[model samples]
Structure formats: structure tokens, C-alpha cells
Target: MKTRILSLILLTVFASAAPAQKNEQNRPPIIDAHVHAFEKDERWTHKVANPLTGQPMTATTEQSHMQATLAEMKKYNVVKAVISNDYQAVLRWKAASPDHIIASYGFYDPSSQDLAFLRREHAAGRLMALGEIGAQYEGIAPNDPKMEPYFALAEELDIPVGIHIGLSKPGIAYDDAPKYRAALSNPLLLEEVLIRHPKIRIYVMHAGWPMLDQMVGLMWAHPQVYVDTGVIDWAVPRKEFHVYLRRLVEAGFGERIMFGSDQMVWPETIGMAVEGIESAAFLTEQQKRDILYNNAVRFFRLDKK
Candidate 1:
């Protein structure tokens, strides 16, 4: 009698769970444009007190971290992620998981060696684009001569540049003196650099928050300009995401928009970004498909493979 009761209870629970599980299984697939992975020792925290104040890196150990990243991608139906990381650190991410994570080489250290490495990796087609670069932190401006070589390499390679130009947290430093605040996060600073490097494609990360209108205006003005929705949720509300998407669509640049989860805090963050895009009122079924995958496929030239 006890065994029969236990079996019946198990059957009842599974019967109720089946449809919900099926619904999840049947949900549309997603392609996360932006995702992050790194070994625990690769963390940039030691360079600075907080990650916001410093460059972003992972804190998990190599063996388990790589497995977790792959598992999350498989479980969430994430087709691919355009990955960029510092030198030395996060090398295992690409070595261990190449299919899911497309790696790019860039180092925060502003030296010729960094640019040289970027040029070499770019020439080998190891990097799809030139960045997660630009002057998010202080003491670096978009037009700094130090960055010209990398820009030139990007032009020669004919790949887009992924730039992070937007408001960071209150405590994050832009330089020795100023913290990365709303005022300094303007996308207009990129104007001079874009003018100088017209041939180079630029994907402005974070969509230039606090100056979002200006960012949209910049994208409208520049034909090669694009934006990715990475780590923007913390700044923009869910409704605002729809509003922004609709605005971009109305501006005739919907096709250029890419979805990025900015998966540093957690693996589930990727799923959250996909859910946000799906839940947005501005996106129709077709638009959702484009934002989730098709756009990235075309932008990254993934279809060629």
C-alpha cells in the first residue's frame, strides 16, 4: 500500500510538471550577442577595489567555470555569444569553449603591446570585431593616439569595433579625478573618433545610457553605427527597453540592433535578457527573431560557416 501511494504521488507531480516543461522546451531559441566568461584567477578585482571601478572579468575557477558557461548556453538555447576579454586571463574560456564563445583579444593596459596583439589576433580572424574598447574608464578618450593603431587594424581587418561608451555605476572611475557619472557618459565623445575612422564599423555597447536619445541620434547619423543591449537593464526599465526599441525601429535602424545579455553577474542573466526582449511590447514575433538571432548571424558573418 505504501509503495503504491508513493508511486501515485510521483505520477501526480510529474503529470502536472509535464506541460510546463514542454512549454519551456517549445519556447523560441535565442542568440546572446554579448556574454562573459573567465577563470577565477583572471578576475580584475585586484587591480581595483570593485569590478564597476575596474574592467569586468570572471571570478570562478577554470574547470568548473567553463563547464557552467557551456551548460547555461545549452540549457538556455543560446546559439552564440560575442566574447571579449583581457589578455592572459579568460584565455581558457576560448580554449575550453570555442563553439559557444567567439573570442576577441583586447587588453585594458594602454600599451603598444596590447594593440600589437589585437592586430595579430584580428588578422587571424580570431576576433569578429575590435572591441569592448573605447574610453569607459578615465584618462582615455576615444581619439587618443594610443588607440589609432588598433583602429587602423580594425579597418584593415574590415571588422566592426565593439565599444563601451556609457554611464557606469556612481563609483566607477573615468580617470584619476572623475567618477564615471551620467555627465561623462555621453556618446558624443565618439564623434571625433568616428569621423576619423569612418570605414571602421562601430557597435556602441550599453547604448550610451543617460544620453540614450543622443546615442540614438548618433546611430541615425552614422550608417555603420550599431548598438547592443548588454547590461542596459540595470539602467533602463523593461518598458523603456520597448520604448527604445520602438524608437530605433522608427528611426530605420531596427535591423542593426543586437541582443546582448552581458553575462558577468550570473549565467541566468543571459536568460533574463532573452526574456526581456521577448516580453517587450515593441517586438513582434518576427522582430524578436531578428533581434535574438538573425541580426547577429548576419553581423558576425556566422552564416558563412
Candidate 2:
């Protein structure tokens, strides 16, 4: 009986240890360069279907959403994330998980007062980056004169600026943002901004999907520019996403691409986004690591952290 019991105990120990070891091998540390936080509101209480899988994603309250996001981060071994949202929401999420969160300022249109507030936040060490700057939704191009001040601020502060430069929700112009224009999605529109603010650190969010030629040209012209595979990583068809990603890599911009879930209300997309990169058979393990973590560390200056 003692021999049998000891054998069973050994089996149990090995069974428990096997999965942990496998998980460690399968899930490498990640640094999500794009994420969002939202205030608890009725807006998130409805199920939204995933565009790629067509599966309904459960809704959550503000508290539950934060909890779920953090849980997802832990599960995937996401060491860090750059989170953008309204000021209060960003603060709450940062407070809840100080070590995991990098606070970013999210804005649509900004006034001088908003710039002042951002300046103060940065001065106080509360804000690290500025973006998800959805100026495109307002029909504003990256080089629009109205956006000069914001870019100037970021350049002056030496913080990275993330701008929305590509596809939004389907029919966004018809229903959600009437000002949104497909022409504005062209990454080339940012050329002037890069020219004027040569020193500004900028990342084109969504990797300027569906605009492959322009995105590659812009990156070739401006080596300082980086991009994040945000919503396109999970929301688009897997094959399509891979084609776009592969082209960028083949064009020799692999080192500049970073991973971003563009995760809004659905926490599951975090895993989906990570899998999107991991599933790319064309990317070697080292290239995958660059996109998933190393690039962001260099882009965000996380080594200082």
C-alpha cells in the first residue's frame, strides 16, 4: 500500500508540474503597446461580436472590465501594457495595477486647456504617453494645423505619440463618426507632421492596415516611425492580417512593428491579438519576440522603468 501511495503522489506532482512548464514555454513575456480603459457605464453592458470569429463577447461593468483585463494580462505573462483612456479611468486602472500599467492620455479633439492638463500630468509623472489620438474620427489629418500644438507638446516632452491612422469600425462614417473619412486613413498624410516634428516619437496605430504601400513608404522614409498591430491583429481575418504583416516584415520593417491588442471592452481579444502574431508561421521565433516585446521596450523606453 505504501509503495502504491508513493507512486500516486509522484504522478500527481509530475502532472501539476508539466502544465506549468509547458505554459512557461508557450507564453512568453509581452508588452502590449496599445490598450484602453473605460469608465463604468451602460455603454459596455451589451455584447459585441468579434469581427473575426463572430462570437459574442460578454459585457462588463467598469470594475469587472479592469479585473478581467488584469487577469488576462497575468494569464498571458504580459509584463507591461500602455493603457489609454480618459484621465480618471486611466488613473484608477494605474492605481489598481501600478506595476503592469503605463498611463497614456487619450483624446479626440483637444483644446489648449487639455494640453495644459496633459502637461501637468506628465510633469507629475502620472502620464507617460499621449494617444490613441483619434483625430481621424474627426476628419482631421495627422498634419492638420489644428493638431500641430498636440504634436509639438509631445515632441517637447519627448514622449511617444500614438495616432489612429487606419480603419475604424465598419460604417464608422455612416453612423458613429460622420466626420471620419477613408482618405484620412492614408499613412502618407503624416509626412508633413514628421517633417515638422522630426524629433517627435510617433507610432502609427493599427499599422495603417489596408494601406500597405503607403505604410511601407512612410516607414522607409521615416526610420523613427514605428507601428503597432492593434485591432487589425484580431479583428481582421487571420490570413489577411498575416499578409499585411508579412509584407511589412519582408520590406524590412520587422524591427519596428510592436504588438497591441487595441483591446477595448473585450479582454479575450488580448489573447487573440497575441495569438495572431504567434500563429504567423513565417515569423521566426526571434522576429516574433521583437514584435511582442523587444520593440515596445525600445519604443516606449521601458528599460528605464
Candidate 3:
């Protein structure tokens, strides 16, 4: 009897909250600015063996991952998602859902991607952006010479770019990626990249978490630089994430903030990320709208299309 009573109360709260959250759907279109559509079975091998340790990572099947991600996308009224994965999978996802998926180039290194292939795809409109460029996970700084050419190419093609920066999981260095360094997580290092590639439309993925001051300082110094709240939105403590987000918005970087789920193997994380922004009491309704959709629309030039 007590269990039944509790279930009723819980259902009531969920039912009541459903309508309130629908207001989010009533707003502008949502764009998930970060995603990786790697086939689940091959996800672990996508990055290849860890050089230092010659070890492998775990996996997620492609079909299952896609089905779940798409369902969640629908559930939340996401009109578009910027997806990054291995070349074949990325192409297939875009080809399969061209209208809903914005194909992006991603990997730990630019060298892993063929420049000619990327150029051809970008020319043909199959690849819309270059990103989740992630060499930062390998202890690389964005300003390194290795990344400048791609930055130039992105500017030349007028394609937006996204790069990983700051606050990866603790002890990530001991995992599959031995090069991971928490010290390299600073967004200030991106200043040189921004200065050199003034025309490139780039967003710092993960919003450079735990580097709030550096993130804010970088955005302040380089107004064109944008950010996406990805893994941190769902992985971090709700209150902690809110505090970081609130600080960014309070510091006057709201317009540049966008949504990204970084939904790898777990598609359920998409809703969690959305809720992170939506449930923030510190954020107003309009602010939520901006973070969920409007800012991304502007950042990705969706309005023009």
C-alpha cells in the first residue's frame, strides 16, 4: 500500500512536470552541437591501440547507439545534431539522415583524417564542420603547428570547428590515452589559435570545465570563440554544473554558450544534458532557450539556411 502510494505521487509529479518541460519544445529548434556516431562494436577500436601501453578500449554498437540517440533527439525536439565519428560511419549517418545530422570531422589527430578526403567532402557538402579535434587529450595545445593548417582550411572553407579542451576525467592519463594531461586543459592556450585564425568559427567543447576563469577570460578576450556544455553537463554534479554554467552566464558569455551532449555510448545522456540546462533555477526561461537552441543556431549559421 505504501509503495503504491509513493508510485502515485511520483507519477503525478512526472505527469505535471511533463507539460512544463514541453515549453522547451515550443521554443526554437535545438541543435546538439556535439555527438559521435561511432558504431558501438567498433567504438573501442576507433582510436586504435594506446601506443604507450598497446591496450584497447571498450565499445558501443552503431545501430543501437544511433537508435537510442535519435529517439532521445526526437523526445527532446532536437532538429539537428552535429555528429562526429569515423569517416565511413560519419558519412553513413549524414547520408542516412542528411537533414537531421550535420556531418563533422573528428578524431584525436588531424593526421588521422585525410586532408584530401575532408576537402572533397567539405566541397561536396557532406562534411559541415571539423571537430571534436581532441588532440588536447593527447597533451596537445590548440596553438600547436599541427592544428594551424586545419584551422586555416576551416576558415577557407567557412566551416565551423570544434575542439576538445579542459577537464577530462580524473586519472584519464592512466587509461587508454597515456598522453592525457590535466595541465594542458587551459583555454588560455587557445588565444594564439584564435589570434591566428580570426575568421574560423570554433567552439571549445566541454566548455573548458574546471577552468571557469580561463574559459571566461578566453571568451572575453576572443569574442568569436564559443563554448558547448557537453560531457560536463551530464557527468558532473548537477549543482556543480549549474554553478559553472551560472558563472559563465553571469560573466556575460551567455550568447556564446551552446548545447552539446557528447553522447558517446550512452544515448540516455542526451536528456540528462538537456535537463542540466533546463533545470537550472539560476537560468531564466529565455536563457535556457538560448543555451538549448538559439545560440547554436547563430553559431552554426543555421538561421541563414
For model 3, which pairs clash?
40-60, 40-61, 40-62, 41-60, 41-61
lDDT of 2 by residue, 1-305 (tens): 00001111111111111113225435778999899888854334434444555444454566777887888888788889889876688899899999999999978775433777889999999989998898888888888899999999999999999998898877767766788888988999999999999999999999998899999999999999999999888888899999999999999999999999998876878989999999999999999999999999999888733
For 69-157, candidate 1 gives per-residue lDDT tens digits of 56667666776777665434445666666677677554443454556666676667566665666344644666667777877777778
What lDDT does model 3 reach? Answer: 0.76
What are the per-residue Cα lDDT tens digits for candidate 3 across 1-305?
Answer: 00001111111111111223344455456789988787543333343322212323222356645765776787778889999866578777777777889888887865555788889988887889998788877667888888888998999999999989876656667765677777878999889888888998999999998899999999999999999998888777888899999999999989999999887655657777887888999888899888988899899988622
Of models 1 and 2, which has the larger TM-score? Answer: 2
* TM-score of predicted structure 3: 0.84
lDDT over C-alpha atoms for residue 120 of model 3: 91
lDDT against the true structure, each candidate: 0.61, 0.83, 0.76
Error of 2 at 279 (Å): 0.5
Better-scoring candidate (TM-score), 1 or 3: 3
